[model samples]
Target: MDTVMKERDLAGKQREAESINFADLSPTSGFFFTSPFRSLSTEGCLTNVSEPAVDGDVINGKFQQAMQAAFSDARAAGIKHPVLCGAIPFDKRQPSALFVPKKTHWIERSAVMAAVQAQESELPAVLSKTELPEQQQFMQMVTDAVKAMNDGKLEKAVLSRLLEIKTRGAVERPALLNRIIDQNPNGYHFHVPLEQGALIGASPELLLRKNGNQFYSNPLAGSARRESCPQQDAEVSRVLLDSGKDLYEHQIVTEGMRQVLADRSRHLHIPATPELLSTPTLWHLSTPIDGDVLDPQENALSLACLLHPTPALCGSPTRIARDLIEQLEPFDRGLFGGIVGWCDDRGNGEWVVTIRCGTVNGDHVRLFAGAGIVPDSSPESEWRETGVKLNTMLRAFGLN
Candidate 1:
């Protein structure tokens, strides 16, 4: 009895350990996401995307009902633990790409990084480069928006431009992911599947995060390009912290979020001042917000939908700013400035603001970046800010 029972017990334990072995994944298919805490790699689909979710009240949200149903479907299919991963579009009217994967492998973020080899990855040669709005047109758009602000049209409008790069050969997703990881290790790295191309980027802004009844968000605004010299970089960081125009822009985002959380939170805390947060390419004014949920039913997706298009991404007086943005900006935003992250069946997840990201499809990639504009904002300066922001992704391709 002792020998046989012990052998069986040892074998069962080994098999359980083998089931969770880290997956060696290819970036071309499925979904992948890594935050400071953990990493998730998924394979086949357990629950594919359904029809677009209907927009409802703040708590029910644009994707909440549909997300809940998807979880139920996975549970019925005998999946003990189900987690949904994908991107939510900037506009709820557009179709989103959220699904529950059939097989999932979870690993620690540190372990994933430790597995990385230091060898340089190869990228394709550039065939051509194009900007959607061109430089002059984008500057003009900014000038007009500033003029409108002077006319009291709205408090602010965050404007974005798109840059498309064509390569002689297909850009390798694995190589690009490696580059981003090697370059920006402390970011919220994601590669979410879209209807057309995959949305891949390392965003520094935390849109929303929920664990049970507690939530956290850190929005970034008022950025300055980082200088190569340490002294200049430090000075730039100091100036960014003191710049009144930048401070006003930062407050617009923080105060707007404070109002949203005030209505939905049982308790809340927001500092009177913003702190400086740095990335590989830029330094930004960041405000971290914390609160406990008033409604236990509101999960990550629900809360994300409610707080998205925050003043940092869109503008204050959201409806009015969106109207102006629609009238001024030429292209459809698609998933830019939207939220991307994962939520398990338990409703705990992290969503990052989709900044410093690009859409990759075959041999071509489209990168998007934006700058927050207020009345005192200069057109040329704003244009330069956007270019510096694009450097975050450009460096991943070894271009910056």
Candidate 2:
């Protein structure tokens, strides 16, 4: 863990880290995590810590124990705050984590210029999916959700659908990640190696980022497709802002965040209204919530666990919406709607909702998207929204 690279070796190591396909660590034991928006990226792994707590309050205790272990390892290696990255599953009990000791060097964009200039390669010509739900089925499910909302069963339930894309050959993950980063320069771009494959995307929402005691969470709920024309896009944003349904959905998320963060933080700040946040394919109603963590020991991941399935991803009345999701959504969400990013031992890190992402396994990749269902939600419109959401990952595959 304390290995040092010579000057020449350092250059070579940096080059390897930048390579689109260069992953020094095994998916089963190690990982590569990055944030292109911050121009910070890291490869290789020094240690992998499993969250031991089964559930409830015990979980954070286990997480804290793991953090102590990682920090101890980092301290021995001369690192102050080692980075830990993994998918915090919607189901918290699942074992999912990758911790890299501070011994590893973090490469910045400036140091990886050669990797960026590397030639782009073509994805396999033929691609297929094991299964895709029929359009009618998804629409009907949405209809049922809307009915449930009107029936007072729940205020909102986010319904998600998965689309599997496969190629004849293994996917060039780094290439695909690079493409997404190129298109979505401002988005939170990430690539996390997994046992089965890897999770990659340009997420538009930030779940939590803790810098010492200060924390920030920007949640997005309401959305509209971004039009190609500037005037048309502005009109669309205006319409989204004016729409009662979208505003209501947006409010649910902001209020939910307030309720969750209020008890844990000394002072929490949330905007009176949501601002328009645009990705390459869609514009969303976004709210930025900032807080001062009362407990200095709480890291980014800890805050993320507290607000993992926000109303933006799940629904109002968290428990009720989660139950409904189980009844409605056919496939397991796995890491979708979960949290992903890096946390450090010094109670600092960034975690973002695992949205606009896909799981890549060999030649196959499964993409996911969800729409918030309110009483007035339109099945057709929700269906279209999922499609627009899928386009973020699809574009990386060179598809429309």
Candidate 3:
């Protein structure tokens, strides 16, 4: 037990209170935005911030080791319960949603979900589709990104795009809800709209979760969309597994997680090999990392601070990749790639990396999508891949 609690008995009582669950607060009709980036700041309202804790700076190997050291230090300090979770900051380089006040009449879920039906709408045309740079120019972007990789400047850079969606008549919140309900598998779909704030993504990455002295994080790095036809899907999965570029991307993420976990805990189990998973539209190579937390004085937010910006979302050799991004990309990511999760008094929380998401601001909505760049990654192909990522959120808006 961490020292935050006076004794093990006291720790039990505190953990009970901290574990209360709340109804999902996703708004019925208001505007909202969440960054893909998660931070201690995002833990507001979910956890009591008064406890003494240490935030792990996961910028380099040093910061990664610091997390493990902090955990052990907390246990030594006599803290009874410590929570650890992952948080990633928003990609400030891409177009994202900014939450604002809802000026329209507030409609209850009953009203919207009752007789109101979602109307058919057309997506805004890609005006001047030809306006985008030529293939060679776009290819230039890939060369530059690759050059950075060769220079050991980065392992991956999420180059994305901004797509616009428009709905006619009153926007149908229920329609969107119904669509998600119909499409969602395993009843895992959760609607977390930004309230007077905005968030980006229908993320599938579970960055971290904390319960007692134990902690968990699910890092998703490689991707391939599932196909309806079983045979075709099998073939697609096979292709993804066979892809050298995709495998390289997955390796970066898996290795990065292994390093971070080792830094925080002694005993860790990471599959020597990654498994393939098929989503509605893409496939991903996933590896689950689990360990006993070494530090109890710190909360889940602190853990998230260290684990975020992992190779899956960001890149390996993080600093160099980040620098190249600062030099090459032309957009601000905001929260599209940040983290979002909840925490409690005893320091228990669960957070996920924001991905497959978009930002909705009033009538105009700006969606974001990114593709991981690797040594064999093609710029033109990567660009198209991002379009696939964009569809995750776009489909949520009933735009497709």
The candidate with the higher TM-score, 2 or 3, is 2
Instruction: Using TM-score, give the best candidate's number.
Output: 1
Model 2: ten consecutive residues of lowest lDDT: 1-10
What order do candidates take by TM-score, descending? 1, 2, 3
Tell me how many clashing residue pairs each candidate has: 0, 0, 63
Give the worst 10-residue stretch by lDDT in candidate 1: 14-23
| Local distance difference test, candidate 2 | 0.74
**Is 1 or 2 the stronger prediction by lDDT?**
1
Q: Which pairs, if any, clash in model 1?
A: none
lDDT rank, highest first?
1, 2, 3
lDDT for position 241 in model 1: 98
C-alpha local distance difference test of each model:
0.80, 0.74, 0.53
Better model by lDDT: candidate 2 vs candidate 3: 2
**Candidate 1: RMSD to truth:** 7.4
